[model samples]
Target: MKRNPVRVTRAAGDIGAQLSAWRRMQSLTAVQVAERANISRDTLRRLEHGDPGVSWGTVLAVARALGALDRVVDALDPFQTDLGRARAAAALPKRVRQ
Candidate 1:
């Protein structure tokens, strides 16, 4: 199946909006967050606007500055639940012996 690039772009924009909203809620300016994250203000602006060309490390730095690194870790954590393990195991095809 083919995926829609436009839909992916929209999702990225939504993520950027959420990040901007979170930063605003914390009473921090883009410059402040960018400086603390050691990123350029323009880079931060592009990220906030979902430019899609930003690097993963830049995003990670911004997230860390926003005190959202824990949430990112939680989202990627593999051992949080037994159900995930079961699902992963079930997805593997059984091996056959000669």
Candidate 2:
């Protein structure tokens, strides 16, 4: 597989770190989180270490287990931002034919 871009790697690391920090703040162990997420401890370790090979479903499961699923969903909502709301108002064509 091709290597990920630097920005992607960096973002993954940051996200992983945040997840780890949250777990710590909640006084949860890796084993506890793994069980809560229905994933293995190794998988949780890889996620906390920012391994880009992890699946999106696994990430969402972990976030949900941590009670952060709503925050994650909100963060990805474009309409939550001023620029995104403005762009939605302008409305692009339904289809683009090259």
Candidate 3:
């Protein structure tokens, strides 16, 4: 199935908003986070606004700086199923078909 890029962008924006909220909750200013992540304040602002152009590495760095990397990783998973070996085996075609 085709994925919607717009939806992904919106999701990223939502995540960025949440990150900003969390940062505010911790009383850390944008400058502080930017400095800690070794990124520019402008870049950090763009990240907080959910700009789609922000690099994943930069996002990770900001998350790490805020002590929120684990939370971010936990939130961004698209596949978390536990199908196991049985499921994989069942998906294969029959020997005759192969």
Q: What is the TM-score of each candidate against the true structure?
A: 0.76, 0.90, 0.72
Greater lDDT among 1 and 2 belongs to: 2
lDDT of 3 at 19: 77
User: Quick one: best lDDT, which candidate?
Assistant: 2
RMSD of each: 5.6, 4.6, 6.4
**Candidate 3 runs further than 4 Å off:** 1-4, 76-98
Residues 26-77, model 1: lDDT tens digits = 9999899999899999999999898777888988899999999889789877
How far residue 19's Cα lies from its native spot in candidate 3, in Å, is: 1.0
Cα lDDT of all candidates, in order? 0.87, 0.93, 0.85
Per model, how many backbone clashes are there? 0, 0, 0
Candidate 2 per-residue lDDT, tens place, 1-98, comes to: 79999999988888889999889999999999999999999999999999888999999999998899899999999999999989987897767899
Residue 26 lDDT (model 1): 100
CA lDDT for candidate 3: 0.85
Error of 1 at 11 (Å): 2.1
Which candidate gets the maximum TM-score versus the true structure? 2
Put down candidate 3 lDDT per residue, 1-98, tens digits, no spaces.
55559988897899789879888999999999999999999998998898878899999999999999987787655343355446656876667653
Residue 63 of model 2: what lDDT?
96
Off by over 4 Å in 1: 1-4, 78-83, 88-98
